[model samples]
Target chain A: MQPSSQMLKGILEGAILQIIQQGDIYGYALHEKLAALGFGDIPEGTIYPLLLKLQRNKLIIGVRRPTGNGPDRKYYHLTDEGEKTLTIFQQQWHQLVQAMTNLNQGDESS
Target chain B: MQPSSQMLKGILEGAILQIIQQGDIYGYALHEKLAALGFGDIPEGTIYPLLLKLQRNKLIIGVRRPTGNGPDRKYYHLTDEGEKTLTIFQQQWHQLVQAMTNLNQGDESS
Candidate 1:
């Protein structure tokens, strides 16, 4: 389901953090990842603004790198703070998943 | 790890969509979910803006209800469009997770 905007905003950072924890990546690559997942129509404009916010918060750092396939790309990597945040996010994600699963199980039983 | 701003923005909607797919919830409840996942320090200001954007995109709808413990709360639910979006997101999320896991495995092997 399309999550409410409020919920979307709440989890955006953690999701992104988890993605980056996998490896260094750029905006377009991240967009492609989202597209592959079924969010093809997501508004491109919204992303840049949120990117700026993450940078300002010091959760990530960026570097410009030349790509063989395209122009120079800005690659973002997680900082120490970012990793810590991701740890927290992952924990929360697991907790939320467990909670929801239990909730669903309750519904099924009742 | 904290994800770059760019990546965070790209994935935010999808994560939120997944959460809502689990059940209807409110902003505070959603925030708590994020917090439980380790995003306790997220900025409060950012969520409302994203919620507005999600509403504008028509992926979610909202209702106001009185709470016994507090004032009126705005509850948001996924629309059909939102559900479709979440399906896409979940697929994408799985793909991303698979890709990352493979990448990590490759790194470990090498």
Candidate 2:
């Protein structure tokens, strides 16, 4: 079955929090990572707006960094608040996966 | 390790696309679903802007429906382009999980 957009939002939010917890990163680099991870067709438009939202929520802060080549890039770093949020998101994500796993297991049992 | 914000953006984008692929839904309902799924701390501000972006990209279209008791709410439905994107995303997400899983397995082996 196809996952609903609502379900996708939760998953995405969790994933986003998890990514930010790793290190400071810029938009293009992030997109490249996603593409490298096999999301080659993922739209280039989605990331910036989401980044802005994440920043607005105080979960992340942005800094301008000079690139070796071309223009300065905006890189995002996780704040303390962002770290706390990631912890919560991680716990929730594990619970969700466990619940889904159990449900799938039950389906197999029946 | 904590995920960087850029990484989070990709995960979230894929997740959001997946959710819309499942069914028609609105911002509040999507947020509620996220909360139910364990993202209780997820800010209410991020979703609408993302939704608008998705809509603007033509991946989703909105319809306003009256609630049984209050005001009408805007619901988003995935377009054909959205479904195609989801297929690509799912393929990519599976690849990501497989790669990560393999890496984890390698770590355990070592």
Candidate 3:
């Protein structure tokens, strides 16, 4: 079964930022990448709006670039603020993992 | 820095249920356990309401027990429904971890 949307909501932005940090990518490719990475099929509806929000927040900046054979694609890359946010995300994610790990151990020991 | 409240919102219930599953626990002790387990300082404001909600949802049942020196404490235990929910939560949490791990690897290899 898929992770509930509510579960995904908290972390999707960080995941998206991490993807963009690796390389500049457009919307469609980002969706594919998330699916490929086992995030499941996240809809474009969810991703596009987040990209806009990220751009609005100035965490990421998007520039329109030609695909040479199709419509212009808006490629996203991390801003300095985005990079910093990504760092915080990583830290928070690690802390979460640690907490879950400890909880699981508690389960095992009990 | 602590994981933002928004980030914690999605998983806190599952974490709470997991704790309850391990054994019966009361409100204040639950808060301390969460803090000790590295969820950070989640306020009683958050925990009490959630316990109420969990009870209302029938995922947990609370029993009032005498403290002898203080007011009775409502000890919480997971219902069968809570057990099923915890299973789903573990699956979802692992999926999230896998996705994050894959993303982290992409960052490292690229």
Candidate 4:
């Protein structure tokens, strides 16, 4: 199951950064790859805007690649900043998980 | 280390709800518990506003209880809707973790 919009709100950017970090990918193609990886149905509206925002923030950069059949595709690639962000995201995520584990286990005793 | 504000924005509400669900707690006490649980240094300004918003949304309700030594403590509890939200949050969280795991693993193979 996919997350609620609210849940996805904070997480999607990091996920997208991670995806782009793996390799450069275009906007539409990202959805397919995200779905294949089990993120479920992500809307183009959400993806494009976040991509623009990431570029504005210097976390990612888009390179226009020519396609014979269509307009040039803006393929996104992660910047070093984005890689650092992903590392922080991973650490924070695991910390939250561990803390939650402690909290849940503490339920029995407290 | 704590998550970035952007990362925590969507998650704090559900975490607060889960905390309240586990036990009736006041705003200040919630922080101590949250920090203890390793959510890191969450500020009072953030918690109070969220508590008010949750109450406004009817997900949580606060009851003022008398404390002999101090002002009344408004303790929070979850509504039926809040419980359902918590369940969904748990499922969504697990789904996200699993999906992220898949995405990362795919990197090695693809």
Candidate 5:
């Protein structure tokens, strides 16, 4: 089931952090990676602004490098703080999933 | 990892809906159930307000009934709308879990 935009909003930041933690990536590449991973068509409009926010929050750092094909691209990589945040997000996510599973399974009795 | 208040704010509405779907329950019982499910110390100040919002949104209805032991308790039960919302939430949640799982595991390759 695809998520509505509202459902996606809270989880997106953590997804982006997980991606950046893999390796440094540029905005456009990040967009494509999300799509490739079955996230559907997440517009650059959505991702670029989030990247800016992550930068503003000091969870990531961006550096510019000349791309042979065009203008310099800004690449994002996680900071130590980003790693810590991702760890917390992962734990919260797993716990949530487990609890939800138990709740749904127990619905028969309730 | 326990979820922070910020992480939970978005998903709490859905969780509450799931609980109501299980059975009609009052505010205090809902609080205890959440703690039992590992949702950790969610206060009534947080839950009661969300219940009001759900009723306002037409996703749930509340009925006050006398419990032999004490003050009337307001029991919350899901509406048709609540059932629909919970279905969507469950779908979105599972998909998000899959994508996150893939991303984290793929971190080795990226």
Candidate 6:
């Protein structure tokens, strides 16, 4: 039941934001989190650029900090604007789910 | 809670096929049906081209018939290929929903 990349691309940003909202995380950890959460193996190539785009859009902010083990990790967290956008994204997502659920239920009944 | 155009674009084909599977439908009626089903006002400009593509892909077949009101109406129905594709789409959609549901539930629990 792997979702196609096209289907993934549309929702990835919101999913990423939701993940970031869960906790501040660096890129590699975020990639791992998406997989653990059942999004499949989304490449770092796709995740990095989206992270940058979200930063540029002011939906997230990243800050480099000491990792105690090695190189500084740029941890990301949702900004105020990011929270608002995520709320809207959740609403839109739920609405879509509702419509599809209704349609499928109709199919079952008929 | 209208899903963004970008979001809708990814799922429209699957939804259309699902609708066509329920019964034969013309383009205008399809548009109306989508809105009534809560997809909002999806333009005919968007649907007609996708229908043509689906026909080209052999997923659907459209036939022009005398509507007894005015000009010929091209009603569309799902092909066997379309049915297969719709099944796959449904699986992918459900997988996505499952992933998001887990993510949101995780959010709420924490």
Model 2, which residues run further than 4 Å from truth?
Answer: A1-110, B1-8, B107-110
Per-residue alpha-carbon lDDT of model 2 for A1-110, expressed as tens digits?
A: 12333333454554555555566778777776554444333455777887888899998999998878999999888888989877776555455444333332332121
Which of the predicted structures, 1 or 3, would earn the higher DockQ when compared with the native? 3
Q: Compose the digit string of candidate 4's lDDT tens values, residues B1-110.
A: 11223333457677788889888999989978877777776779878998999999899999999999888899999999899877777666566666777777764222
True contacts kept of 1: 0.03
Candidates 2 and 5, the one with greater DockQ: 5
lDDT by residue for model 1 (A1-110), tens = 22333333455556566667788878777766644443343455755566667888899888998878879988888989999977766555544444434333433221
Where model 6 places Cα greater than 4 Å from the true spot, the runs are A1-9, A68-71, A107-110, B1-9, B107-110
- DockQ of each two-chain model: 0.09, 0.09, 0.28, 0.25, 0.19, 0.22
TM-scores for candidates 1 onward, in order: 0.49, 0.50, 0.86, 0.83, 0.81, 0.85
What does the interface RMSD come to for each candidate? 9.7, 9.3, 8.4, 8.2, 8.6, 8.3
DockQ ranking from best to worst? 3, 4, 6, 5, 1, 2
Which ranges of candidate 3 are over 4 A from the true structure? A1-9, A107-110, B1-9, B107-110
lDDT tens digits, residue span B26-106, model 2: 888777655544433345677888788888988889999998999889988888898886666655555544433433233
C-alpha displacement of A94 in model 1, angstroms? Answer: 11
Overall lDDT per candidate, in order of appearance: 0.60, 0.60, 0.81, 0.75, 0.75, 0.79
What is the Å distance of residue A43 in model 2 from its true position? 19
Backbone clash total for model 3 is 0
Candidate 6, A1-110: lDDT as tens digits: 12223332468888889989988989988888777766667788888998999999999999999979999889999999999988877877776776787788663221
Residues A2-108 of candidate 5 have per-residue lDDT tens digits of 12223323577878888998889999998888766655557788789989999998999999999898988999999999899877776666666666666767632
Higher-ranked by TM-score: 2 or 3: 3
